[model samples]
Target: MHDSIFIKSLFNTLYFVFIGTPFVIAFQLATALILNIEVKGINIFRTLYYLPYLVPMVASVIIWIIIFGHTGVVNQILGLVGLGPFDWIQNVHLIKPVIIAMGMWAAGSGILIFLAGLKGVPTHLYEVAKIDGAGPIKRFIHVTLPMITPTILFSVVMQSIAYFQMFTESYILNKGGPDYASTTYLVNTYNTAFRDFDFGLAMAQSWILFIIILIITLIVMRSSKSWVYYEAGNGR
Candidate 1:
């Protein structure tokens, strides 16, 4: 609790969780919604969306580094718009954000899960909703959203924990650099235990992280009772 560095790293970790996770979820849901419909080449589009997740994480992070690098593809495109040649790697303020952005690129796993959930939704439910005068938005809100609450809960919990333990991408990108602005909890834990040889403190720090993640997961799980739907029970 008293380790300021741990506190800072925890904040950075949660920043990634709170900020990055929702967007990733939104992307997954939106992409899944679009891909859920019957359309020619939908399978191809689904495969394309999932390909990024299948790429090795280390390799993908390296690719992202090159793309977001100072004079990399993004900056060149930005140059066309006269916007950015910004130091994405070295800028302290941008370090975590860029790392978070990297997570969004491989959201294929989430998209797949959401797609399954969407496809599993009963077609009869939509028919019933429509019979009650529910339009598209209302059908989605009253039926689709409720039907997918279980999927949403699953994604939220899993993504939160994944983002909380983030280390590799940040470490590889710039070694959590530029004043450790992107030094996530796990990354700092590694440095503290291995680099600083503060095994005791690092072990304690890790336990704290475990407890925090557990609590957060429990909270989400607890809240799901009111929202998550199960067709088998037809009740919460």
Candidate 2:
């Protein structure tokens, strides 16, 4: 029984990670790339993009719930477009997309990290690429990507950790209802501990999450030496 419960919780955690991490990473990387370009009012845009990250998690989730509710802004917009009201959080097929959308709203930290990495990339490397007739695409492939691999890996690890603990949105928005569509591992563990008073199982689940995170982090670190480049004379 204990082993079965552990396996179930592990599967749930992995499910959340798989569903969420790609969206977070892709959105952050896109935002970072856009912000890295030379443009007017970039700082203002960056601040706006990052504003959601500053909002408390509970408050953010509440705000999203209001926006995605049946009579909320989203349905209202759909009505304006002559479409019937649709349930967002309550729809099993839409719940994951809704969560991914919400997660994208708080991707500012990752964008900022990537931007910093972009800035630190040696200008001379780009110049060398240009001298060798490398176009923007080539430059990005040979110079930008290799230099930013560390930042990308770091953001992936951090976001994976965050997504593994996702519970607030599901709890506040749908309470993991609609046939357990948004029943993340963290929510399940919380329900087990508080609602069911299964303290021992909760404790075991928590340790399992901790061990999973530790193992993944160690794997990332072990793999980093091969591709993550540090500047010469700077031991990072």
Candidate 1's C-alpha runs over 4 A off are: none
| Tens-digit per-residue lDDT, 1-236, candidate 2 | 53454455456557668767877887888788898888899899989998999999899989998999999999999999899698888898788788888989977788889889889899999999999999999999999888888788888789889878888877887887666767777888898899889999799888987888899889978888777777673323
TM-score of 1: 0.95
Best-matching candidate per TM-score: 1
lDDT of each: 0.89, 0.82
lDDT for model 1: 0.89
- Mind giving the per-residue lDDT tens digits that candidate 1 earns over 136-199? 9999999899889989999999999999888889888988787778889999999998999999
Which consecutive 10 residues in model 1 have the weakest lDDT in total? 1-10
Clashes of each: 0, 0
